[model samples]
Target: MTVFDDGERPRGGGPWPIWGIPLVLSLCGLVMIASLSLRNSMTGGSPYAQIVKQCVFFLSGLVLMFACAFSSLRRFRRWSGLLWFIALLLLVGTLIPGLGVRVGGARRWLDLRLMRFQPLEFLLLAVPLFLADRLDRSRREGFQGFLRPTLMVTLLSILPLLFQPNLGGTILVTLICLMMHVENRGWRYPLMGGAFMVVLFVSLVMIEPYRMRRFLAFWDPWSDPMNKGFQIIQGLVAFCNGRLFGVGIGKGLQEDEYLPAAQTDYIFPAIGEEFGLAGTLFLLSLYAVWTIRAYRIYRRCSNPFLSVLTLGLTMSIIGPMFINIGGVTKLMPLTGIPLPFVSAGGSAMLFMWAKVGILMRINKISLGEGRREREPEGC
Candidate 1:
């Protein structure tokens, strides 16, 4: 089970610290979604609908999570090719007429009878597994060898992602690829990759008038307060009402209609409005702890494949989180991505938990091996 080094392995984490963050966050999300749902009932829809559906997503995601956690890594690796093919098919499927469901002028989903499925979210899981398999196999192939798989994986995912007109997803998938390369090669690749991504970002923004407008809105939302800047302005206002101590849960006005997408995209702002800055900071801190602990697992893993897999998964979680936070706070342009474990979205919730499951599986393997090695030495 030696991955690469002969150094002492760090012990596996206990359930409390590692598991607590997501549980607390998920509970908080459900509560917030439930409270938000109250207003929908007033509008004639069932109040319980959102909460019930969210519960279904959580249960389904847990099933997916356990399935992933229990599966052998070899199985996932073996399925990597199939995962990539499925990812591509789903991505393209979302772009076809009558097949892909269009929302807000962007085609990025398939209308499954039970629930809409977003293929971009699936890429978060599939692309990394694909790269880790490729990169691990290319270990001795030099940079030339590594470069081929990295480029192949990146191009395959990125092209279809952009066609969906999901700027956020395009950026995210690119970052995930860069992150894996950074783990294998060094930080320099990200610098190079960042420059390339920057060019891609700017070109896409410039080509689309809405993106350009949104980009401008990020810098100065007040210039057109009632139109392009409304969401940002409302979100900031929600935070201001929250102050240090929140206005109190279900007491905040933002979710009532002040902030557009208060449920999915701007859930953090709603949280800040109701629970205050303390609540927002608490959520961010949870993510920080999760990231640190997950990274620690990555560092401790001996198998090169598992280590790369660990790093990729960790990056995937944090990237959307910070992006969503930054967008709401106006530090960057809003990308319409839901906050991880906090946003009310079936596809995101499903995959986010699934990623956690895989990481747990890796953690189990790492710790079990450590225990077996230590047992013979009578330590």
Candidate 2:
């Protein structure tokens, strides 16, 4: 029998299960978001307002995803650097006093008339796309050949994220780049990358007082509930309120008044309270299924660009999702990153769905190439 005879046949279209999982997760997230925000919508405006905006972002992301998916990975390789530069421009604009929009204190969003956007969202895609193309291409020369360009590009991508004071995003973006390094150069590069990150994180914590407080709170949040630990305390309260099943959708006490950012960073706690442990577990399982499927896509794709793209996309999805959930549950410190798919943010939803679209498109390539065999050490 041929090598392809092991039930790994070329799919007529893309692998449906890969795309289907995230699509289902997004749909479920939308339903939950609508239900969770129902009271907020009613009190703040119309009951459907948040849902309408989310739908618009979701649809737009779908379009972008498909467009990227069908396009040549070579085309992405050519233009990704330009896209990164554009994102950098937007990031610089965000730092400007009036150009960037400020919600609580961090000026991270740009006021783009119709809607606000966080430039970091674009970096999530652009950086990975560029790195996948460049790193995979560099494998022809040698792993060492990739060192200078990789470091330069990775640093350029990270500087903007760090300056935003978005430690969560910076760590995630760095890891995404490091994943490409692992696929190309192996553990040595990623370990070096990890060591550098440790130093950077140490420096950051030392320089910032609030960051130190968050570290302390991670150790024991209740020590300062009204100050450094208010959010986590409220999150714990929400979890306690959820006994076995849940309080039911739209019936969470956390959203009623107690927890701040209940709809954003603390949304998971609200889910635990309203939907109960069963509901939270159901959602988490979807994410786990999605990650496994994404890695399978990476493993199956023949093209190195497609492989790296899948890995990057997986990190983008899994990293922030786990961190956000962990934070709200007080398993980790409170880092203000949004819950994937479920959080109410236009830029994040649009960018996230667009990446999903790219994954779907790559699956088409994998199927067309016939049952893809395991790629070599260099992605």
Candidate 3:
């Protein structure tokens, strides 16, 4: 497929599934969290605390979404550098003496007095905006022209995440940057790039013993059932418990007692336990629809910056979705990234909305471009 597959905007399409699917998924998250919160309350773990916090996050996420949607894409392009720089600082801050919060032995969060924030999530949006702005044809284009900036951004971004020991984010961000820079020129480049990516992943796994163990555990979780495999095993049990139609919304056994990250990393399995195969399939379909629609926006986009930005933004969501689901389902080692709109992560929710907002802006601009193109036909 050529870089930006611009074509006649799909028929019967005005405001498409891009926005609607996330709203549905976000609502599902809220309902699921509320259910989990109720169970926590029953166990005397502070009633509705999870829901209350998530409610605040959900509202704040909407604000971030609208702010991005209404703002000028030009401004984002202009400010992409500053935003990325600030993100870099925050990411580095996560490693500072007292500034960083240690969770699961990884310093990936900042425990501000009010709440915790993951700078990594912000980087997901910032890196794309930066790359789209810097790599646009207006400044420079083509493989040789864009290679330096792409490598620089990838190295700078990936290093801190690696130190944070966030292999998943590192891989996702690195690949997204690589994916954005590929030109339509012939097979040699992509083939080489693909080989490079494989080497990079293998190297990354080899460098970290924990990562290697996880990789091996992915192939046979039974080998390390108590340690590396526990989360996936629990997640699988949730799927088993869910079976077909699930045990009912609030009645799930996994989220209440067994499942490891029922509201975040393993939320997919929790969804399985409560919603069943039918519900899980429906949710998967929503994600599929969301992915297809985002690409549709990318394809129709006329501007070069917006075009690359659309692909990058689409990756920000879909990449995490695949990584998280893969880990939970034992398709791959769990990287501990939250599911897109369905995870109960505050930083994740805010950034997820930000991505959707940017796409909405692009969709609006593309539609306008389409309308303007059609106006001359009437004359």
Best candidate per lDDT, number?
1
lDDT of prediction 3: 0.81
The sequence of per-residue lDDT tens digits that candidate 1 reaches over residues 278-366 is 99989988999898888778767766777888888888889999899999998889988999988998999999988988888777776
Q: Which run of 10 residues does model 2 get worst, by summed lDDT?
A: 1-10
lDDT for 361 (candidate 1): 72
- For candidate 2, report its TM-score: 0.89
Q: Which 10-residue window in model 1 sums to the lowest lDDT?
A: 370-379
TM-scores, all models, native as reference? 0.93, 0.89, 0.91
Candidate 1 Cα deviation (angstroms), residue 176: 0.9
Cα distance off (Å), candidate 2, residue 221: 1.7
Task: Give the candidates in order of TM-score, highest first.
Answer: 1, 3, 2
Off by over 4 Å in 1: 1-9, 139-143, 369-379
lDDT of 2 by residue, 29-128 (tens): 6776787666765476677877788888877777777786666555566788898889888888888877888765667799888888899888888888
Top candidate by TM-score: 1
TM-score of 1: 0.93
Number of the candidate with higher lDDT, 1 or 3: 1
Clashes of each: 1, 0, 0
